[model samples]
Target: MNPAAQEPLDPRDRPARLTVGVVGAGRVGPALAAALRLAGHRPVAVSGVSDASVRRAATLLPDVPVVTPAEVLARAELVLLTVPDDALAALVQGLAETGAVRPGQLLLHTSGRYGTKVLDPALRAGALPLALHPAMTFTGTSVDVQRLAGCSFGVTAPEELRLAAEALVIEMGGEAEWIAEESRPLYHAALALGANHLVTLVAQSMELLRAAGVEAPDRMLGPLLGAALDNALRSGDAALTGPVARGDAGTVAAHVEVLREHAPAAVAGYLAMARTTADRALAHGMLKPEMAEDLLDVLADGDSLGDTRGGAGGGAR
Candidate 1:
């Protein structure tokens, strides 16, 4: 035998190009399959239920056969179960029950909420299980594949299969951050709380700016928000600023009244968030105790806005 042929392959090395399949060609599935294709894997088949998913598959994975879920497992050496988080369990159980999962085949899911435990049925059927969740958001566009470069993947797998998981993430241009199986839920929740809520907060700020007569809210917010985000990432609680952080109770009270008049629906959220901010600032010694009392009272009482209504002008009516 030749010397190279006689050597055993390293477990952490990328596996030879495998035939890939996608069970749900939603925004994430086709994008990941496309990335894998870029890594020299062959996307042999994909299954998509909705018209949108079918179209997306055609866009991101042109020429790959669109087949049934069972057919996808039948033909692929590496199957990506990219269905909605809610439907993943049922789909896996169904696949396992139908004997569709094959021995030694690789089965991966893109769910952040779950680790490999959800793949136990497939595991019992001799399928290799991997939970590789990209921490970045996907737009169902070709850009998502490019975005995967330097992305962080929350990875969980069997001890024996750890290297294989890392290899796949590396192939997709992602750095693997191993998450303990038991910590998956908390890990996912933190992502949702930060990323999802940040979108809501930014949109709300833009709407409020528009109400304040800013002609181009996006332009005004771009640099401010960018710097704020960078500062928060670098300094954590020490980076906090604005009226709440300064313990400016009068300024906050004025804001509450303005919001109550202009955006009554947003008043409750504003109060809740300000209280939380106040708590953090005080705990970190950014807010003096004496300064906190009035701020807490302003945040605690909805009627506190009434005190600031006199200077609110005739437009308040």
Candidate 2:
């Protein structure tokens, strides 16, 4: 028996601060590397291909050298692979095949859709794998460092590496939430549905208001949307309001008709959301089953009503 192997590691003995390398200096990579630097880790090198990325690296990691991906991997103890999700596997495999990734190096990726499985190639090359995805969006600016504070990081790592993963997240001023490896896709989908789709929804709403001749759509929407978002986040289903939540099928029908006539591109989205809202209201006991049926009927009749060329009648009144 190796006596040293049986000895317990002391919690007080913290691991040495790592020399970090960024493989992609896109919006997420440089921002995260900057946060790591603030956390006392050193960002030694970065790889950026685009002109914008090179400019961003200069802004966020001014002292760090811009180098090739292989050089970045070869020089750092902690490697951050922040490329697009589709590009990650190939990059890791290429690094491994080239013998650039070293044994015992910690390799982390900022991909929301992927967990440590995508790092299998690096693992095979004896690198430790961690998946750490920040929940907020980034603009590839220094401001993202402040945004990262108090944000949740969806982390996936082997049980033995959990502490290391969590500690790194903490150092970057983030809260680490362990996500099961199999749940990565679902987790990422939820974030996309909430954040990405919300942006599209808001843009469509602003356009609709502009079509209606509102001079300052943002001024009109700012407070209402902000309150609605805050309520929805704080109260969930209980926060739901508006015609669909109130089970006013006629109001929804009228809205669909107007959108079809004026903003045909938005009608489909409106109908889909109204139907979903009605279903949710019903499930939450906020709407009676009969009222839900009525709402669903209106949503189903949207296309036929669009052909009528008449304003929605008394039901809307």
Candidate 3:
């Protein structure tokens, strides 16, 4: 067993502060750097290409100089790579090829989809790789720092560096949830399905509501959506409700027709979600097969609804 793996790092009492540097001033990097600064780590440098990023770095990391990526690595003991998922590998390769990675530096990336494998090049250059992806959304603002207080971070690192990774997340006021290297992709997909797709579904629902003459769509849906989310979180599949769960085939069929007429683009999404909801309801015994027969037929015919748009009959009214 590696001795360092068992050592606990004090979040606020570490006298030996590692100078932190951000390689991309995207929302995540600056916010994380700001949080670390709160825990007594010095933010030395950061790099960002866009004007917005420069402004963001200045806001979150006041007095911390914005420098080139190579300069950031040269100046700091801990480097945060907060680039997009697609750009991460290439950026790491570029840094390594340029001989910029400092030996023994804590090289951490904030990408959820990748684990330590993507940091292998940096690791070969004598860097200690860490993957610490915060499982919370970033709004590219200071509020993101506050949101980290009770947030969970998806952590992945070599066994020897697990303590180091957890310490970093803890220092940022986050819980460390260790994800296996092979399971990182699946973990990220689950998050995206829950968080990212939720935004799309809400936006579509709001748009359809507006088209149906509902004013203040957000206001109208806020309480209902909030309760639904809370219920699902608390009860899981037992939280299933609405026309689909009740096997109200007529109501489901009417919803399909309204979406087809009022918002043609939302028809497919509505159908897909309804079908998924029905499947889950059935699996959980919330929906009976005999009752679902007509509901299934309605969903199965969703593809043809796009072409045969009739007058809107039923909606949020």
TM-score leader: 3
* Superposition-based RMSD of candidate 1 using all C-alpha atoms, in angstroms: 6.6
Instruction: Check candidate 2 and list the clashing pairs.
Output: none
TM-score of 3: 0.91
Off by over 4 Å in 2: 1-15, 304-317
The digit string of per-residue lDDT tens for model 3 on 208-246 reads 788878999999999999999999999999998899899
Off by over 4 Å in 1: 1-15, 303-317
Q: Candidate 1, residue 192: CA error in Å?
A: 0.5
State the lDDT of candidate 2 residue by residue for 80-146, as single tens digits.
9999999999999999999898777789999999999999988898888999999999988889999
lDDT of 3: 0.87
lDDT of 2: 0.86
Residue 234's lDDT within candidate 2 is: 95
lDDT of each: 0.87, 0.86, 0.87
Model 1, 1-317: lDDT tens digits are 12442233343443588779999999999999999999999999999988999999999999999999999988887899999899999999999999999777889999999999999999998888999999998899999999999999999999988988898899999999999999999999999988998888889999999988999999999999999999999999999999999999999989888888988877766776787788789889998888888887777665455443223221101
How many clashing residue pairs appear in each of the predictions shown? 0, 0, 0
Error of 3 at 160 (Å): 1.1
